[model samples]
Target: MSFPRSATRSALALAGAGVLVLAWGGSAVAAQQGSTTVEPAGAAFSATLDGEATFETGPITVTCAVSASDPGDGNNLVPDEPDNHNPEGAVGGPINAPNFDDCEADVPLVDVEVEVADAVWDMSMQDGESAVGTMHVPAAGIVVTTSGVASCTATVSPDADVDIEGTWTNGDPVSSLAFDTTAPIEVEGGVGCPDDTEAGFTAAYEVENADDADTPITVGP
Candidate 1:
């Protein structure tokens, strides 16, 4: 999300990220139950659904009441390397797919189920313009199940990349992660799937330290 990818999860909000920011694969992103973060130098962090997290595909919109990163430990700063994603340093995320609850669809009587890939999603913080950097959903696809009016299963296949944007106020974790931009999501499902193959995702997550609930996650230089 808006935060460092290699850092934490708002979802911990994929742009539905809680960019939970679930990841593709490489390192894990940390969440609560003791999720951690090292900071600007580089570290893992955890986040939660600040307000709400949503996923839209075709005409169907999925709304989740709760979202969070898989709880774990990590987000410590890595030493500088010649060609690392995090110039200041890099920290492998300690996490998995964001968890969801109270989820429903814009369409009537439709139940939505999301199964994040099992394992630590990839979280790589990109080199930023300043102390601030950008965090995209680590990587991995979300398996979504729809039943009732809509009977079918869909997956945010292969690569789902979304950014978690922030206001840049001294780089502090906020109550929400604003995906300043939209990310494209790919889907593969049965005949019950939406007519269109393309889908869009947007969301905001409230980020914080998983381990230290009181301590706000911050990125510094």
Candidate 2:
């Protein structure tokens, strides 16, 4: 199925708003039984659950970033857009230009799917406890479009979740990570990402030097 940029942006924006609320001492909900959490880890990603299991929809952040270094900078490259037959949308066609001259140009990164366990009342951690939710990623990476802001989506039940995306320049760095909450959501049974995975939860990102000419992308927590 195709992803709706507006819908995803709304969902993620709402979630990110919830995170801000909690950060500012606002109340947030947790699932009664199942819950899931997702976060970024540098270039890799990870997820977890508490009570029941959940599935990820994959990263779905729509990127609108093109670099001056990118051969397609002036050509135009749109990512995750069905209309754009070429995902990289570089210039001169692949035959004329085989590789992305600005392959490292800062692009958006989003996780479309995240699987978690069903939330259970008595079998899981007490409500509002850290155990009830999972910590996904500490930070994420982002690409700025001609427009200044970027957005993404993340879903979580009874569990509280946060995922970050960073934006940086060669000298100065600034980052943003959209958040999501599936609180007050009901799960069939109580399950989450397995315990083994929980211990190794990761926080990945697609790093970019927004102001640099030859910036190489890096991924990490």
Candidate 3:
């Protein structure tokens, strides 16, 4: 199955958001509950990224919703349960899933939102070391907004990481940012597409500004 540019944008958006959540998880400060805004200290640059993504085997497709929020307690970054939330949280919503061969007929995936209540982001950019961070989605849940047997809420532990290599400039950002995963991101909860499936993806984007550039990132199967 081929994922269009829009689907890739959604995938990258989720990955980008995952980056922030994991970065703050490493050293999140105390904040109010459900606070969805965080700017990491010593951040060389940041941007609202868009890209497409697909499940490696089933080709399950989705689009991402753009949003932002702050980090929460790093300790509770990886929750033991699903749909868990911290005082400050991250939420992706209103995603639509079209019918796939493996999916039930006319059972479109709708209102798909992944909520992370507790998460942590650990990042480093030392020489010979790729900038990387891991996020634990404690109480993470994916809600199928559509109505059908496939529309049930499924628990997902979206443990994701981001690795990039480029020269960092305060005002001048790198020309582009490349993203990849070392292994397949596994999704639990008996959901089709990603659940019980290995999802691997690679994305590349042209950086307009190091400080903050709204660039379009593209992902390929």
Relative to the true structure, candidate 1 has a C-alpha RMSD (angstroms) of 9.8
lDDT of each: 0.41, 0.19, 0.25
TM-score, model 1 to reference: 0.59
Q: Which of the predicted structures, 1 or 3, would earn the higher TM-score when compared with the native?
A: 1
Best by lDDT: 1
TM-scores for candidates 1 onward, in order:
0.59, 0.17, 0.38
CA deviation > 4 Å runs, candidate 1: 1-44, 73-91, 127-140, 159-176, 180-192, 211-214
Q: How many residue pairs clash per model?
A: 38, 62, 31
- Predicted candidate 1 versus true structure: per-residue lDDT over 1-221, tens digit per residue: 22222211121122221111111111122221222223433323555666655665434455667766644444322323322233345334434456666665534434445565554344433323422223435444455554444345444434544443333222344433443333444444454444334454455556555545455555333
lDDT of 3 at 128: 14
Kindly list the per-residue Cα lDDT of model 2 for residues 1-221, writing each as its tens digit: 11111111211111121110001001233333322211111111111111211111222122212211121222112112232122221111110111101111112332222222222111001122222222221121111111112222222222443321112111112221111322222112112211111111111122233334243322111
For TM-score, the strongest prediction is: 1
How does model 2 fare in lDDT?
A: 0.19
**How would the candidate models be sorted by TM-score, starting from the highest?**
1, 3, 2
Ranking of candidates on lDDT, top first: 1, 3, 2
